[model samples]
Target: MLEESIRPDNLALVIVLQACGILAGKEVPVNEKGEKTMALEIGRALHYDLRTFMLEFDNFVCTALLNLYGKCGAMIEAENVFMSFVSLDVVSWSAMLSAYVDQNCGEKALLLYRQMLQEGLQVDAVTSVVVLQACSALAESERTLVIARNTRKTAALEIGRAVHADAYKKQFAYDLAVGNTIINMYGNCGVLSEAEHVFGVLNIRNIVTWNAMIAAYAEQGEDEQALMLFKEMHKHCITADEVTLIFALKASCSMGCLDVCHCLYFDIICAGRETSSLSASLIHAYGRCASLKDATSFLNELSEFHLGSWNACITSYAGEGDCTSSLFLLEEMKLMGIKPDGLTFISVISACSHTGIVVEGAECFMSMSCAFRIVPEGKHYGSIVDLFARAGDFSRVNSLLKSMPMPSDESVWLCLLGACHTHYNVELAKYAFDHALMVQPKHAAAYVALSNVYAYAGIQDAICGPKGTN
Candidate 1:
């Protein structure tokens, strides 16, 4: 239109800006060079033309420009447009706050929020929702910081609660998006009850609301409750999305609810929503329910495999005591270039231990750190020790114990003691028993293993022998 010498009015420019904002919100297709294509360039051109037309100072146009730039990940340009506002209204402030949020600049959004409040502007529902999201992002950052510094002073949750209170005071709590954000904020803070309370009182419920509540239950290990809510959601005729299905599948897996799993699996198939995650969840659920055949069948139905799907199927086989199948899947996964994660190795190593494949188990354990760059955790160490102990490799067990960065725990000691009982190694059983007691005085398995060791040695009278007796 501009090339034809057609003069577009402010209304036309506003519509163009709105289109740009929508395009920015959608995932822009990138070219081979990883740069966004012509849509973003058109947005920039429209922005420049708005400046040329001197309509940039108009509040609505300015807010739209800010939104468009923010959605495009052009935070600097968005901030520039926001600063150009001669008089900031609630819409402008909200747009800028949303822009900061879109760019994941949560701290900046919070700072802008403080400035907005100081200006004594009346915050509306949209503004409240944006601020709540900023609070959520800040809460996540606080969690990361707490983990890094090993401190528990998290101000983000407090800020979020205050925001929630403010939303209620402003009568914005009834807004669907606002209510959902509040639920999500509380859920993310590990306050499931508060999330549930908010969910219960929500005058209107949507799929997002149900998903949030279900996810909260699933996250807190309330699988039964999550499934119950899912049923309730169905009664209300609310459709489940992929997220809802994922949470439901997780709850089913946790509780070994095979009936629920089968129902959800059929629903997924009918809906053509068979994602890798869902398939993985089905495999895990079947495995937990002691149906390795069903799990393997489900895994085979997948046209493509992700690392998670592979891991789940491998774990299912391992759990079924099918060590051969587990190892076979591991090799297949490697051949397919799906790098095994820690969980994969844990399952694979456990399978080797079960089948007494000592050499392969040791090689897998070593490859975790050597080839995969995954430093073995305590569980991996425990699995390897169990493997060696099962093979009666007492020297390797001792060497692994010494190589451990931290002191051995009760489980590790229990594994060693069990091996001693199996081999009638009286002296090593005494050592393992003492270490286990040091770690956990009431370790029942360790005590039982020690007793069995004495019985196997025909020294039943010395069951409660001297502390250091062999």
Candidate 2:
């Protein structure tokens, strides 16, 4: 197609590019600036004029626009067009909400949906799917469950069940997407047993249904069940997609099952479908299992790789305490014309902390958002705290703690407290212990660590302090 020397405004050129985006679906690389620019250019050409091009750019065309921008991470542009209308049909709302959900902005999507609902907009299955995703993002929070459950009041489950019942009232509960979401809903609520029961009753299982069950097992740390379900899925003639591999490998990684991780890593490669994401997941699994050599070997074998793949490799190396390799990979990623994301930097910073690369880690942390335009999330700040704490720079750690835009999580303070214990920094340990208590008052592990700090510092008289606090 590039050989034809076609003009940018040509209709055929626009159709071909749009067709490519459709063909690639979710697996396509949207993080690359060049790829996104090309997609946007093609979309502009296809749509041409928002005012004049009236015939082809109907609801379908608008949906295509929403998808094109959404996939390319042009969410604001997508929303601008989406919210410009006085009247929105269900498909329009679904498309926009789906754009946000697909981009992992479930909070924003949910907010917009509630606004739509208040405005008397009706939601259908696709909208429900997006909302369920919002629920999943809130799964770890007990408050999230109460809010989601109470707000909907069984509406999500009931509406989904009703859809299935409407499909076949005699059998009542039979539909692929509905069953899939129900499993997901239960899984999100941490009701794994219920999820399993529903999953077992499914007469026909699609990839999504299988993935939901596998992910639920993984979330519950049921490594054996997760692995067994993968095998069962294969026996039942359900083909494994990239999602299945990622979730199953996550279980293997968490269990530190090096053999299983290695096997799945090879399987992904042997399947000859080398998405950057799958490559990253394999690297992460190997990293979590502490198999750095295997992770390195897998990364080196990738003939075609990208920034995300390299970031995953760096993350594994960092987690394995190989800061030199992690930094080297980060440099290599930049040299390959792929910009590092916040996650890439987080792993790199973690590598520095592991190896006590204080100056490098500090500089990276300071420049993270400035240089890479990647804002540091909680995980990144946690890495920074680890870096300072490892260097026994307690004051710097405390400064970082105070500077956080959001309240620091328990793990951040725990990292500081552990480092203080390692370096016999009693005063700092106490400070971190106090913060941890405030963040997570009922944490037994933090209390134990604080007790150890007091004992190690000859503050045995202060033992009463920790005991009373507990």
Candidate 3:
């Protein structure tokens, strides 16, 4: 009705609404009174035609459309709309580049950034930050690393410093977000001292700054310093959330700090974020400390048990050499309709090996493929072979070897060979050794096992070839 009347103000309002429709990823819902006001207001801005629909829209409207497309991974649509513009400015370029980088097309982002530079477009802070991220992403490939390292060496931190330096030639060292990026860049580059120096001088510190430092320390296995900094974080009233706690728990687990992990577990529970993975970590910590009862009780108390939680408890029991409990848990998992994954099966097989439950282990191995359709990996096969070999079922072990659809791994062959040597089966030991050697040509362990077999049988001289009869 408004378009037929040729009302310029009403038509502008419709154009605005249409742009918003594409921006918000929805069609505009109808409203009357508000439409009239918007129509009158947008009339003061640009006019639009069919091809100029996106481009002639207000900057805010156009940018929002680009953002929506970028965020949703409609890169082609985004590019089409971006290139449709008769005039391309910095914000327009940044929007498109951010989309490319965010969607993991970092190399393309870099190419566009170079094009932007060749056009003498003035890059602003947000644009520089996006390019910095692309630099970090590009660091994984050596060829890409050279490009990123050179770009970062020029643009990221030094630009921040230079921009500040140009103010009466006085360099201001601290811009919170920029400083944090520099800290991150330095930390990622393994220049920890420089990162620490930058971090110490920063006037404002956010969780990102702290997280960067903590991750840097954690990656280096500096658990003590990471924990100390974590304490400092709490003192500074920076509440450590899930990401913080997960990394701390990993450090605690690595350092065998069961008491610390236990305390964190209660803290997590009190915070009302009892995620299964967190609970699993607690079980792992307790299990590592040989506290099987505590691990079992913790698992039982949880309202829902996931695969990780179950695997943690099973592995704990197996590690403690209590295969019966591990087997019991495996059965319970099945009864609960939780089919065993590869890790779960391996944990149970380990338990059986420790406790000499040969028959049960064999049944579990068969069930892995037949019932679950989970093909046994080399590690799983090795564990089962070890179980049977340890139980002195040489015939069963030989049959398993012959029946394996996949080639036997070196570890599997080694397990069988070790068992043969232990049971004084010389012929079987020789066969196992040969197979192991076939799998791993430079297997010094196999050579040692074979020499011992000959020595034990008082045929060492023949094997060593009475070659000078040394």
Two-way lDDT contest, 1 vs 3, winner? 1
TM-score: model 2 vs. ground truth: 0.65
Model 2 regions lying over 4 Å from their true place: 1-172, 327-341, 357-385, 394-414, 420-470
The regions of model 3 sitting more than 4 angstroms off are 1-203, 407-410, 413-470
How many residue pairs clash in all the candidates, one count each? 0, 0, 0
Model 2: per-residue Cα lDDT over 342-393, one tens digit each: 8888888988988889998888887777787777888888889999888888
Cα displacement (angstroms), candidate 3, residue 156, comes to 18
Q: Candidate 1 residues 253-338, lDDT tens each?
A: 89988888889988888888878787788788888888888888877787777778889989988887888899889888888888
After superposition on all C-alphas, the RMSD of every candidate to the true structure, in Å, is 8.8, 7.1, 11.1
Candidate 3 local accuracy as lDDT? 0.71
lDDT score, candidate 2, position 360: 84
Deviation of model 1 at 414, angstroms: 20
If the candidates were sorted by their lDDT against the true structure, best first, what order would they fall in?
A: 1, 2, 3
Q: List the residue pairs that clash in candidate 2.
A: none
User: How far out, in Å, is residue 275 in model 1?
Assistant: 3.2
Maximum-lDDT candidate? 1
